[model samples]
Target: MAEMIEYNCPSCGGKLEFDSTSQKMKCPFCDSIFEIDTIQQYYAEMENSDKSTMNWDTQAGTEWQDGEADKIGVYSCQSCGGDIVADSTTAASKCPYCDNPVVMTGSLSGDLKPDFVIPFKLDKKAAKEALNRYLDGKRLLPKVFRTENHIDEIKGVYVPVWLFDAGVNARMMYKAEKRRMWSDASYSYTETSYYSAVRAGKIDFELVPVDGSTKMDDDIMESIEPYRFNEAVDFQTAYLSGYMADRYDVSAEESIKRANERIKKSTEQIFAQTVKGYSSVVNESSRINLTNGKAKYALYPVWMLNTTWNGNKYTFAMNGQTGKFVGNLPVDKSAAIRWFAGITAVATAVLFGLSFLL
Candidate 1:
C-alpha cells in the first residue's frame, strides 16, 4: 500500500522539516539538528517490525463533486509523460511541461502524484516583463530577434523534480605545496615544500533537487536553482487549474546519477576550501559514501517561453517565484564581426596618430 510518512524529530515529538538554508533536518519544537540517516533508519526498523501488506485504491484524478469536470480536459504528451489539464474550450497544442506537441490521452491512473508543489508566485505579466528585460541591453543580439521574433508560447508549468536527502561520509586527499623565495647579492634562491593533505568528515545534504523531465536540459534547469522549500505546500489537483504539470517520466533512479555528481563535486569543493595556508593544492583522490539516500518527488514552478529564429529554436525560462531568468539567445555573427572591426580600426588609428606625433 502507498503510505505517506512524516518524519518526527527524535528530540521531541514534533514534525521534522528539511531546512534548505542549513541543509539539515531541523526540529522547530526542540531546536535540534539531525542527520537524515537517523530518520531513515527509524523508518526502516518500523517497516521491518510490521510486515503486513495492504493494498490501496489510488485514484489519479481528483473526484469532482461540483460538476466541474465537464469543463476540464486532461491531455498527455507523447514525447514526455506530461499530463496537461486545461479548459475544454482551450486547445492544448503544446505540452507546457516540456514544450512538446501534446497528444490527447487518458488520465495517468497509475502514475505517482507529487508530494508537494510550489505554486506560481509570478503571473504571466511578470514573466513577459522579465523576458523583455532579459532582451534589453544586449547589443550583440540581432535587432530583429529582439523585436520581430514572436514568442511562440509562454506557459506556467509545474515541472517534476526529485529532491534528494543524504548524509555523506567523505574522504579527500590533496597534494599541497608551499613556496619560499630569497634573493642574495649574487643569486636568487627558491625553496619549495610539498606535503600530502588528507581530510575526512560527515556532511548532510538536504533537498538537493534534480529535474525529472527528459526533455528539460539539466544545465539550463540548474541555473534557476534554490527553490524555497519552506514555501512548498501539500499537492492538490486544484493547484493545476490554470497551470500545467507532469508526472515524472525519468525515474528517481535515473535522476540520482546527476544528484550524486553534483553532491560529490560540492563535497570536494567544500572540503578543499578547508585546506588553507597552502600556496597551491591539487586534488589527488576523493571518496564519498552516501547514507540515508532518500528521494522525495516535488513540483517546482517555472515560466517558460519558446520561439524559433533562423530555423533554430530559442527557449527562455524564469523561476516563477524568484524571477531568475536563464536562456541562451542566438548571437548575431555579422554584428559581432562589425564590432570587432570597429574596435580594431579605432586602436590602429590611435597608434598611428601617436607614432606621427613622436
Candidate 2:
C-alpha cells in the first residue's frame, strides 16, 4: 500500500500541490509534471496496484476512506506534467487555475491504451448560457424552472471518453430477391426473382467516438454527438484549467469492444442499403479491419446540475466546453396539466364558434 497523499517536486525538490481546476497535480515549485499513469506504474512496480483501483459497479465504490494512507499516493497530469493530488477514492476534479482534468491515467497492467480524447474548450459562463438558451426556446415549461432554476451551481465536469478510427475494407456477399408485377386483363400476377452478388468497398471511418464512464450513461453522451475530432489538439492540462474531469474507470479494451459492436451494426446497415429489394438475405462473408488504431486518455466537458423536483433528483448537464444542453429537466406537472387543459378548452370554444358560424 502506498501513502494516501504524497507530493514531491522532481525538478526543484520543492513541495508540490494538486490543482483541481487544471486537472493536474502540479509541482507549483518547479512546474515539473507527472500524471496518474505514473502512480499506476509506481504501484504496479511494487505489485500493490489493487489498493488504488475501485470497482464502479459496487455500491460503496472504491472503499476510499477519506484519509486512507494506504491508497495510491499521487498522480501526475499527463497533459501539463503537473503533480495532481487525487482523492484515491473520488474520480473527478479540475485544476484550480489551468482547468485540466488530472485523472487516473491508466488501469491496465496488461495491454490497452486510449485511442483519442476530445478535450474541453468551452468555459463555465458559456455553458450556462447554452443551457439558458435551450430553456428559452422550450414552451410549456414552468416559469419557475425557466427562470428560477439557477445554473449558478451547475458544476462543470469533463467526462472520460474513447475515440477510434478504422479503415474497413468490406467484402460482403449476399443473395437478394427483386419483385415484379404484371397485370392481365382482369387480374395481376406478381413474380419475384432471386439474385446473388458480391459487394466490396473500403470506407475509412475518420474517428468514431465513444464515452468512457459509467458515471454518466452513453445515451446522454451520444445526444451531444459529433465531437470535432479534427479540432482535437493534443491533450493539454490548460484545456481542463476551469472544468472538472473524471479519470478513465472503464478500460480501453472494454470500450474498443463496444466500438467494434457499433461498427458491425453500421456495416450491416450500409450493406443492407446497398442490397435493397431483398426478401430474405444472407451475408456469406464480411470483413472489417482496425487500421491505424490510436487511443488517448482524455477528459470531456459536461455541466452537471442536481436539482430536486418533488423529492426526486433531476440531473442536468450542459457540455461544459461546448455548451450543449443535456440532463433531465425539472418540471411542475400540475402546472403543465393546467396549461394544457386551459389551452385545450380555449381551442375547443374557438372550434365550436367557427362551426356555428359556418
Candidate 3:
C-alpha cells in the first residue's frame, strides 16, 4: 500500500489547491487562502497529535495475471477511498473520483526528495493565451489543426530536473590570419599573415538545468531557454497540490554528462571571444577542466499539451514561470507552394521593369 497526502481546508474541509495567481493554497469551495508555511506547520501539528493505527488485510484479491502489474502503482485515495492507478514515475496527481489532489509521500522520501521547487507563476489561463498568440501569425499553418487541437487538455506538470554547478578552467589556442590588400597601377597585391592566439580563463556556472524525465524531448525542453531560479522556494508536499509531478528516473550521473557538454561548449566560446582583431580564426586546440562540480534535484513547472493530427502527434509546451510557448506545427504544402509562386511572380515583374528602364 502507498501513502498519500491530501490537503484539506481547516475552515470548511474543502480541498485546497495551490493557486498560482495568489502564490498560496486556496480553497475553491470556501474561498479561504493560507500561506504555504502556515499550512505545512498546521498539518505537522495535526499529524503529531493523531495516533498511529495499522490495519492489515490478510485476504488476497484476484491475482494479477503475468506481466499485468508491471510499471503500474495503485494507491488508495484518502478522501474518497478510491484506488488511484498511475505510472511508476508519477509522484503527484489528483483523484479522478473525488478530484482531491494527492502527493505520494513515499515517492519523495529519503533520497528522492527534491531540494527546491519553482512553483507555477502563470496559471492555465495564461498558458492558453500564450498558445493563441503562438498560433495567431503562422500563415502557413494548417487550418484544420486549429479547429481539431484539444486545447482543453492542457495540463500543468512539475518536471524533475538536475541543476549542476561547476567551476571550469579553459585554455584554447587559435590559428588566426590577417589579410592586407594593395592595388597599384601595374599590379594588385594581397598579403596574408598568420598568427597563433591563445586564451586561458576560469569561469563558474550555477544552476545549469538538464531535464530528468525521459518522456520529455530534450530539444523541446532546451528551446524553453531558462527558468528564474531566484523565485524558487524550498520543496514542500503542499506545492504539489493540483498538479502532476514526475520522479527523477534519470540519475544525476547520467545527467552530468550533458551538463559537462554544455559547460565545455560555453567555456570554449567565452575563451574564444578574447581572440580578436583577426580576419579569420580557427580553433587549433582546447582543454577544459571542471572543479567543484555539484548536482541538485528540483522540479520546474511546465504547461504541456499533446495533440494528434493526420496520424502524427504534436506536442506543445509553455514555461509555467515565464509564459514562453513552443511547439511544432504542421505546414500546408499547397499554401506554401502558392506563397512561393506569388513571391516569384513579384520578383519577375520587378526584374522586367528594371530591364525596361535600362
Candidate 4:
C-alpha cells in the first residue's frame, strides 16, 4: 500500500487547495490562506515522522484469490482514511470520498523525488479561454469540433522533465566567399574572393528540458518551447495538491542522449552566428566537446486537453507559465478546396488582365 499526504487548513481545519492566482493554499470553507513557506515546515515534519506507527495488520483483509489485483494499487488517505485506489503510475490524485488532494509519498521518495517544480500559474479557467482563442480564427477547422469538444476535461498537470546543463567547447571551420561585380562601358567584371574562417569558443547552456515521461508526445512538448526556470521553486508535495503529477519512469541516463543532441545543435548554431559578413558560408569541419554535463529532475506545469472529434482523438497542451498553446486541429476538406479554388480564380483573372494590357 502507498502512503498519501493531504494539506488541511490550520485555521478552520478545512481542506486546503493551492490557488494559482494567490500562489498560496486557500481553505475552501473558511477562506483562510497560507503561504508556501509555512507549509514547507509541515511537509518537513511529515518527512521526518516516525514510521513505526504506520504498520497495518495485513491479516484482516480478504486475500486476493489469484492475480485479480495485479494492476490495482490501494492507498490510505491521510485525511479521511478512505482507500484511494489508483494505477501504478499515478503519483498524485484527488480523494473521492473527502474531496481532498492526495500525493503518493512513496512514489516521490528517495531517488524518485524531483529537485524543482514550477507551480501552476494559470488556472483551469485560463486554459478554457485559451482554447476558445485558439479556435476563433481557424477558418478551416471543423465547425462541429467547437460544439462537440469537451472543454471541462482540461486538466493541469505537473509533467516530469529532465533539465540538463552543460558547458561546450567547440572549434569550427567554414568556407566563405565574397563576390564583387562591376560594369564598365565596354565590359562587365566579376571577382570572387574565397576565405577560410575558423572559430573556437566555449559556451554554456542551462536548463535544457526534455520530457521524462514516455506518455507525453515529444513533438508536442517541444512545440511549447520553454518554461521559465527562473520561476521554479524547490519541489514540495504541497504544490501538487490540486494537480496531477507523474513520477519519472525514464531514467536520467536514458535521457542524456536527447540532451546531448539539443546541446550540440545549439552550439553549432551559436558558433555559426560568428561567421558573418560574407556572401555565403558553408561548414567545412566541426568538433565539439562537452564538459560538466548534469541532469536535474524537475516538474513543469502544463494544461492538457484530450478530445475526440470525428472518431479521431486530438491532444492539446498549454504552457501553464507562459500561456502558450499548441495542438493539431483537423482541417475541413471542403473549406480547403473552396479556398484553393478562390486563389486559382484570382490568379487566372490577373494573368488574363496582364495579357490583354500587353
Highest TM-score: which candidate? Answer: 3
CA lDDT for candidate 3 = 0.89
lDDT of 3 by residue, 1-358 (tens): 6677889999999889999999999999999999999999999998899957646362477877787775677788888888898877788998999988989877788999999999999998898888888989798998888878776478889999999999998889999999999999999998999999988888999999999999778787788859999999999989989999888889999999898899899888888888889999999999899874669999999999777888888889999999889999999999999999999999999999999999
Ranking of candidates on lDDT, top first = 3, 4, 1, 2
- Could you give the candidate ranking by TM-score, starting with the highest? 3, 4, 1, 2
TM-score of each: 0.69, 0.60, 0.95, 0.88
Winner on lDDT between 2 and 3 is: 3
Superposed Cα deviation of residue 134, candidate 3 (Å): 0.7
TM-score preference between candidates 1 and 3, better one: 3
Per-candidate Cα RMSD to the true structure, in Å, reads: 13.8, 9.5, 2.0, 3.2
lDDT of 1 by residue, 1-358 (tens): 1122345667776655444334455666698976555656775797799876544353676688786876666554434545556554332235568554331222222356678878677878888899999999998999999878789989877778999998889999999999999999999998999999999998999999999876577777799998899988766433443455555668899988888888898999999999999999999999998874669888888889999998899999999778899999988899999999999999999999999999
Instruction: Assess candidate 1 and give its lDDT.
Output: 0.74
- Which pairs of residues have clashing backbones in candidate 3? none
Candidate 2 segments whose C-alpha is farther than 4 A from its true place: 1-86, 89-119, 140-144, 173-175, 276-294, 330-358
Candidate 4 contains a number of clashing pairs equal to 0
Model 4 poorest 10 in a row by lDDT: 50-59
lDDT accuracy of residue 7 in candidate 4: 83
